[model samples]
Target chain A: MNRSAFPPLNLRWLMPLLLALPLLVQAADPLPSWNDGPSKKAIESFVSAVTSEGSKDFVQPAERIAVFDNDGTLWSEQPMYFQVLFAFAEVKRLAPQHPEWKEQQPFKAVLEGDQKTLAASGMDGIIKIVGATHTGLSNEAFIDNAEAWLAKAVHPKSQKPFTEMVYQPMLELLAYLRANGFKTYIVSGGDVTFMRAFAEEVYGIPPEQVIGTTFVTQFQNQDGKLSILRTPKLAHNDDGPGKPESIDSIIGRRPIFAFGNSDGDLQMLQWTAAGSGKRFTGLVHHTDAKREWAYDRESKVGKLDKALDQAKAEGWTVVDMAAEWRQVFPFATATSGQ
Target chain B: MNRSAFPPLNLRWLMPLLLALPLLVQAADPLPSWNDGPSKKAIESFVSAVTSEGSKDFVQPAERIAVFDNDGTLWSEQPMYFQVLFAFAEVKRLAPQHPEWKEQQPFKAVLEGDQKTLAASGMDGIIKIVGATHTGLSNEAFIDNAEAWLAKAVHPKSQKPFTEMVYQPMLELLAYLRANGFKTYIVSGGDVTFMRAFAEEVYGIPPEQVIGTTFVTQFQNQDGKLSILRTPKLAHNDDGPGKPESIDSIIGRRPIFAFGNSDGDLQMLQWTAAGSGKRFTGLVHHTDAKREWAYDRESKVGKLDKALDQAKAEGWTVVDMAAEWRQVFPFATATSGQ
Candidate 1:
């Protein structure tokens, strides 16, 4: 039977042929926003090598753990970190509750809109602001306040909701890794509970997979009902060296892949690199002043100095946001689902 | 065109038919060791109600979280908690290295095997013992010691490895819940790291899903390599009210089902019960003295006083181990993985 003897098939045959044709074709690019560069190529190569069965780098599905640093890596952390801004707003919100806050240095600076004095106050001022707003409420109440704020809070420059400011390329990378049997986790310097509110919806990461700084919480039994109350004291810092420490304590596994932006994530990248296996480490270089903020070593928040230097020396992929990504935030496309 | 004529077919049809027939049959009973009682009935009914789509109690798969206490619930905790035993053994193991331990109060009691004096020392003494054995080493070192001890250590009464002391009915229940879309987590008063070593192999729950008491750890850079050294300091004590606090902090979602045995678990049960929609709470009564050690109100360890009262008053399923379980430990069955 010569195949050339047959003409084009009927509508029924054409329908089934059309339906099955795509399966035989090459799949669509998972990270479309990512420019065709060495950074994207490295990610693709790493994922393929690890996931292909019978290969030397084949990792079991359970062991395919990937951790990401939240602030500068997944979303923008510029002109000051978003959480610091939230803290300042919180100081204003709670100003009426404590009359003495009007006279307080950090509180007064925040209330007076004096960024210079607040910056001079340093981490001590930030901690005080965070503790004042984040603690002294039931866990549910704190979560409610955070959720309400996130619903309305917008980026100062972008004029987009804070959630919408997440990197589209990174979002695509998360989905791609997950599709290849990786469990993505957010190991952040931000509050664990605060990150949890939007992590699931924004990054497709569940709450249990998010590890971050924590405040001391007290269990309360009021009128025979149990509730957890967030306290003023800090529990775990989850920054710098605390990143790897929290990873070991909570995750109980060395992640094969780690992505970060700043020096705070340097230890996490080092830990991942130290693991005896096929590992991938990436640093997001915020070099996009036109599309996004671009302060590095001199920046107060998310300073990416040591990590950027180390990434080059260690052969870790350094994602130049301006050059490597076609788009920065997800709000560029209507179908991005920010 | 007659379907009846095609039934009297070839061996090819018969072979595929034989293979597919088992798929149509009803599934085997997942909880075969559980006796027919109100406790068993309640569990089955609750799981079925919540899992059935379009039902009033239907729950999403992501929300089907179940938490369980370790000691006295999953395994035996009589004669003293297994961890306390491990601490005592560790004290003896490290006695030669620290000759000063001979003169210390808790250390001397632990080294001398003086149960009476150790009991008098209370939680303070236990904490000291735990700190000495569990901390000061790297995370890997601590896990290795715990794993080594668990491998050789036998229950005094049962003369079996402590891992073999897990309740068979509860194991079946875990499998049942998981089969019905529930994710089981061990939220225990025991050490989190200690549980992770065996939880995956024995209980089928992964380390990431386990939440328990934590010890302070410091990040160390030894010869340019990073390591997290467990400190000789107590961190969060996940007991009684701390159970709920840890759950809120770590899991970040209220469990729909909670299983526990003692007063340490009361708050966890209360927290689970307090959640809206379908919820289940279970308590193992420790009523089987013949098969397993039994104790309740006045017992120093595995005390089940207030929780038992609450279980009765709040319609929580109280599992009478003696009457409700056909077998206690999984060792009885030849097919059991243990």
Candidate 2:
């Protein structure tokens, strides 16, 4: 009689609870900042499929390489690219040294806050400005100047430090992937050294993992001390087609995951998707006008035109920022604009 | 209570044993392949000092960067560089495709097995041979070819695979540094792509961590598939001054430790030593003619003149292969000749 009474106490209840315990703990949401949607689902599923042991889609930890475009994908890239803004500010800072800059077309446009003329100056004009402002300094000095500027530099719209404006969802994604054994790398169009100045602090990506446009540097032995001097000459233009080329040359392995925000990342995504095995590609579409600056085909900085089309055709996840993200910037308060 | 009665259990006997436990376990010879000598002492002491918490010489894990030259420093480069041998073999492999190579100066020299003529051709001639054989293939194809050749190719004298010819002491050193949280990188003059094919397997260094001379690669999209095609154009010559330049551009941080066996690594050593903290510089002096081929100033491959002199003047550790290393090649048996 006692056995019958105790047996009815139902071990069934504990069975389901025990079964759900592993799922609850093992599947803690890696990307909490991400709103529950297809983009987040795509990322989570891909990571799970690749990381699960004995699964056909399982990729070894060493082969789980992920590449991300730095500017709009990882952080805000408007009113213009942050590095370009730095160049403009540098133009103003160095204008006293060269009074001619006050009259120079691009430099004058930069000094006068003329966005239209600056855009009209084209890549050649931009290169000249970058050369004039970004070169001839030792790497240490350049890094110091960049770091100091970054420390104080605020976004034009957000009025928050640029580093603080990095997308919280993306940061979560980066950490999520890294925790899943993915080696995250920044394959950006920005200056490699400039990105290195803030990458580790802001993104938790070390300098060695930040691959970007490189300026020619010369090793100088001056008075028994050695220094690497940055030169104006562009060593590798890691943009568009250059992205895949640089990744192949530098990383040597084709990445299984790639994230980008513009046409400059088109080839990279293509290259990643073309790899033999499961691959994941994501495009951060800036559709959040109120929370963050929204621009696509018509916008100059971080233009998302061709890559947007390619993402649709290739079944790549297109992250509609306004909808997919519960929060935009890491520093955003309830009342603060994204 | 029974202090005198039990003779205090000889408590003092346990003191030295307990104190030595940590020293015995934690300080087990990390570099057993290295003999008990100044070179080993220098390496052990440098590692201990930098890794010791609260020590003035303590380097943060992130800052514990070490760069190693691949050719003579990690592996044997005598009887001509193994990569050069590979190039020569490639020239022969592709002779059918280029009938003109039969008559071309450098190509003809390589195809004809004319070492004297190839040597007489100087750097220019060698470049021609490398350009002819090491280019035109897609990166994947080139790496496949390189890996296939490495799989089958044996050293002319030792009959050992080139990878097996790597020094055991250096391998131990690499593992030791890695165990101490040091990031190891290969900053070599060898082709960056070539070294990458076997770097991970041979040295436990990843492709992204291998910095070397780069050949220009063009992104090719063929039938909706993306491939990076290696070109004959030399992009960056990562040797001598270029070593420091490439290290700065690629690694972004100055290495605290640098190891090399040639003048080509002079700037790298200088740059490492010139860093603002305690640094280690090691020169692998090829002094074991009987055990391994020895040629320094007079050798075309792995020249070790200027750097050797500089190492002595700068107090950099000079590792004599014969004396400092208990074993040279990793596969060496006790009775095996160098």
* Cand. 1 Cα-lDDT: 0.88
The global Cα lDDT (0 to 1) of model 2 is: 0.88
Question: What is the C-alpha lDDT profile of model 2 across A1-338, one tens digit per residue?
Answer: 34335322323445456557868967687787788889989998999899999999999998999999999999989877899889888888888999988787988999998988988998887888889878999999999989989999888887899899899999999998898899999999999989999999999999989999988889999888778899888899999999999898888889999999999999999999999899999999999888888899998788889989989987999998888888888777542212
Candidate 1 versus truth, CA RMSD in Å, comes to 6.6
Instruction: Please list, in the order the candidates appear, how each scores on TM-score for chain B only.
Output: 0.91, 0.91
Candidate 2, residues B1-338, lDDT tens digits: the string is 44235332223445456657867868688888888889889998999899999999999999999999989999999788888899989989989989998888999888788888988999898788888878988888888889999999999999988889998989999999999999999999999989998999999999989999899999998888677889898999989999999888888888999999999999999999988879999999998887787788888788889998989998999987888788888788652212
> Which runs of model 1 end up more than 4 angstroms from their true locations?
A1-26, A96-100, A333-338, B1-27, B333-338
Instruction: Report the C-alpha displacement of residue A147, candidate 1, in angstroms.
Output: 1.5
The interface RMSD for candidate 2 is 13.2
Q: Candidate 1, B304: how far from true, in Å?
A: 0.6
TM-score of chain A of 1: 0.91
Best model number under lDDT: 2
For B99-124, candidate 1 gives per-residue lDDT tens digits of 99999999998888788898999999
